[model samples]
Target chain A: MTAAQGFRHGLRTAIVSVFALVLVGTYVSVGALAHDFGFSASWVAAQTVLIWAAPAQVIMITAMGAGASPLEVAIAVGLSAVRLMPMVVALLPILRTPRTRGWQLVITAHFTAASMWIEALRLAPDVPREARIGFANGLGVAFMSVAVASAVGGYFLAFSLPTALVAALLFLTPSSFLIGAIRNSRRMVDWLALAFGLALAPVLALGAVRLDLLWTGLVGGTAAYLVQRLRGGR
Target chain B: MSVLGDLWPYVVLVLVGFLPNEIWRWLGVVAAHRAGEQSEFLTWARAVATAVLAGVVAKIIFFAPGALASVPLAVRLAATVVAVIAYLLIRRSIFAGVLCGSIALVLGGLVLAP
Candidate 1:
């Protein structure tokens, strides 16, 4: 394929992911939660505008309502966002074109996350570096729009919905994450992280003061890293 | 909502979320300059990111709490597996995985989720 064609193909793939997963699935999940929980519509809207991350936003809203300590909530919310660091790192080779210097990247970095990052990552090999950020930003803009609209509207809808249905919709928040996580695993570290995080949640819940799911991430992420290094760095 | 009341908190929240994001972005750029090539740090980042994604997904599908929290573990798990297979069949397209799994969940609820 011509370079232009390759860029278009990569852009198309990224856009598809933005619409299906980021816009449709993640927004639907968050909208469901917004309708059931007292999460501020404006705050969640701002998060999408800025964070564009689904899992961390969801956890932050729920944890706040639970009256969980600020530290606990921050750690859980912050730890889940650890995924962002690696996500950005993985996309480095792809996004470094034009040497996208200083302020421009800082402006755009807010746009990176699982769906966009993952799409850029898988298809970057074929795309020219110059086009990667544009394509990614395009995808990010689409996801951000859906989330802000969904969150604001869903917050208003919650005032009218029956308790039972609101309950089911709320369930979709985590369900979206669960499905996405299962689909994203490509390496041994992924498998271990999934296993360790899942196992850690219930075990932590057993404690007098839950070990906080956030730590599970630090522990699981660290353990996976160590094990991967030991296994000949495969 | 007075500017000083409900809206103010949100203004602060937006500023807070925005700060870290920018810091990371700058850090990404600075770090990128130093590490033009993929290094162990990047590898570690990828591994941790993958694990986090996996964990988050597993928690939602198999272990989420709610009114439907009573849904049996096996059924929830089976639905996720169906989604995974669908994703694989589609050559790892997450769009296919999420939609397929959501459908599988509804169908499962219709059929076996008593």
Candidate 2:
């Protein structure tokens, strides 16, 4: 298929799947939380567009609400986004071709969030080499459009929404991330990493370390990798 | 000066939020170009990323920073447990799992609210 056809196919897949509604749920939560934190609707929308990672956006809102300086917030948000590096690394090989321009990959890289990475890793291999980039770009754009709209809607709706509902909305982000990570687990190391990360986070936080999340992942992930190695597994 | 003041938040959002996140993605593209797909490094990177994300998820669930913190800890744990169980039982239906978790949270908040 041509680039346009690939794009159309991606748009159809995103809309027809649970992706659009799930994003609506997640981004609406983000919008409402941004409102609660005194951020303007446009700020949240811009965040959804630029960051395009709900967890990092949520971390930014929470940090700013807690009066963290921009530098501090950047550290936290940056740590949260480290996952995107590896995700993009994994995804680019699927989408890249010999003729694929660096600029196109750069654009596609910007759209490489958890969900897009997941979808691309699963679907890009089936796409023609020339069309994979288009397909991934299409997926990213569709998700971004939905997310921005819902974030604005949620910001406006926060005033009328009940606290209980707001709490429920806020839970969606973490729940989805956890489930997605679990769903994508294929090896012993992957499962062990999730388990170890979960087990380590609260423990590390108790020490009040400046970068507890970073330590949790490093220690837990390294431990998991070692365990897999000792088990004679790849 | 006033315009700059008004724009500082956006600047912060881009600098602190967008740039921090976007830089890694760019690095990944370059790294992928150099290293190709499968490698020992890629596997370790994936594991590290997954762990870090899982750590973030654990932080959010256990020590939630915003609206979610209002719900009791038990409620949050229960909701998360329910989500995982539902996801596994429902053939890995993500929507069903999240929906069930949300329902449990709302219900727990309502029923347990004083």
Candidate 3:
């Protein structure tokens, strides 16, 4: 497949996927919350473009609302984003081939979020090596468009939307992500990581607010890795 | 200038929100070039990422930040449990899971509204 064809395929898949609808619902919630917190619509839309990750965006906006300093906001957002490093690490290598340019890898990394990453990882194998970059980029562009538009629209709709409906919308991302994690689980380590992370988060939240996720990921992931090693499983 | 002051929030967002987040992706791109995809280090990284995301999911559900916090924690937890069970028993359909979960949340909020 050529780059264009791969791009088209990915674009079509993301546009039609059930996950895209969930993204729309989630970002609408994000936009509404940002509006409630007195952020301009452009601010939320820009966040959708730049941060792209829902969890990090939520953290930054809420922290800002709570009057956290800029430095504090950066630290919290950065901590939430540490997960992206590993996702990009796992994904870029799959998309890269002999002809893949350094610039392409750099550009693609910006578009790597959970939605695009999952789709790309699942779909890259079927794409020709040379076209994988286009495919992933297409997914990134489609999701970004959907997310940003929904956010801006939600900002406008925030006034009329009921609190109950907004609450329901906020539930979309976490439920969808949890289900996605369960679907992606293929091994004991994966299951253990999910279990450990879910159990550790509430406990860690009782202590420090800023570093809970960082600790959860580190401790839970390490525990899973060690358990897998002890079981002699790859 | 007054214009610069007006633009300060966007400026802060770019510096604080965009840069901090994008730096990790850049780091990953640099690292992926050196490490094979299936290497043990990459495996560990994947586990770490997955765990972190799972933590985010739990955070949003259990200790929700915004409007979700308005709904009682028990309702939120029950909705999530219902969603997971529905997803597993219903052909692993993500749509079904999210839909059921969302319906439960809305209904729970209504029933438990004070």
Candidate 4:
């Protein structure tokens, strides 16, 4: 198959795989937010589209509902999203080509969240560089669509669905990430990072609720990196 | 109500929230241009990223807010183990792993419910 065809195929597979999982989590969470906050479905949908990150969206919605000021919500959400930096750094080189336009990269950057990043990182190696952006865009557009729909659906269904089902749906996004981490486990450093992150998260949470992720990430990751370095590098 | 008065706060929130996230991504693009994957900065950054993602997942599973808080710790851990096992058996298929984990959690909740 040609490079373009390979990219197209990969894109379709990613869209299907991500769509099946992403919606349930975002839908349920946004629905819960709407029910709790008395937010309109339209408002929730707009947030989903604009924020485009599930964890941050959840933080923003929940904090705002709890009567946090907009500035506070923004800071918390933005800090939560600091993880996206490494994702974008790792992904851009693979998708970019000398011939690739600046606007294309900007657009791709906007779409680079966890699910999309995972799929792109997995798929880009095989796809021709010229086609990588296209592949990412396909996954991004599909992901965004499902995200918006799920937010709206959850908003309505939050009132009607069984709590158990909604709870199950809430687990979907994290489950997907955990699975992705497992699938991408190639180096000892990766495993160390995961272990440290898991071990440190709860401890960090005791002190800092909103910034726990950032702290855990920095400390745990640096520890893992140092360990790998001390071991003569992986 | 004036549109600006009502919407400006949300607009500000969007900008404030977006800038922090986007700044990192934009910086990443620039760094990627200058540095190879083998660079120390990239390596450390990648490690940090994985840790952050892991931390988030751990938080969701163990210390989740709202409805998920009701799930027992044993069930959550069991579901994760089952999911990991499924991922390995399936040659690391993410879909299979997630499917097994979600099913395990739901089933655990059902069987273990009081």
DockQ, per model, reads: 0.41, 0.65, 0.73, 0.61
lDDT of 4 by residue, A171-227 (tens): 776778887886776888888988998888887886666578888888999999999
Candidate number of the best DockQ = 3
Error of 4 at B104 (Å): 2.0
- For candidate 3, the docking band is medium
DockQ of 2: 0.65
Q: By summed lDDT, which 10 consecutive residues of candidate 2 chain B come out lowest? A: B35-44
Residue A131 CA displacement from its true place in model 1, Å = 1.7
Candidate 2, pairs of clashing residues: none
lDDT, each prediction: 0.60, 0.84, 0.87, 0.75
- CAPRI grade, predicted model 2: medium
Best by TM-score: 3
Q: What is the TM-score of each predicted model, taking all chains together?
A: 0.75, 0.88, 0.92, 0.90
Summarize candidate 1's per-residue lDDT along A1-234 as a digit string, tens digits.
Answer: 443454456456644552433454446556657556665666677766766777667776677667776667656665556556556665665566655666656545677766666555655655566666666666566656656777676666645655334434444444445545655566776667667777765555455334344566667777877887799655
Kindly indicate the candidate among 2 and 3 with the higher DockQ.
3
Model 1, residue B10: C-alpha shift (Å):
2.2
The candidate that wins on lDDT is 3
True contacts kept of each: 0.36, 0.78, 0.80, 0.60
The residue-by-residue lDDT of candidate 3 on A65-86, one tens digit each, is 9999999999988977888898
Question: What is the descending DockQ order?
Answer: 3, 2, 4, 1
Better of 2 and 4 by TM-score: 4
**Clash pairs for candidate 3:** none
User: Order of candidates by lDDT, top first?
Assistant: 3, 2, 4, 1
**What ranges in model 3 sit over 4 Å off?**
A65-67, B2-7
What are the runs in model 1 whose C-alpha is more than 4 Å off? A1-12, A35-43, A63-76, A157-234, B15-33, B67-70, B90-93, B112-114
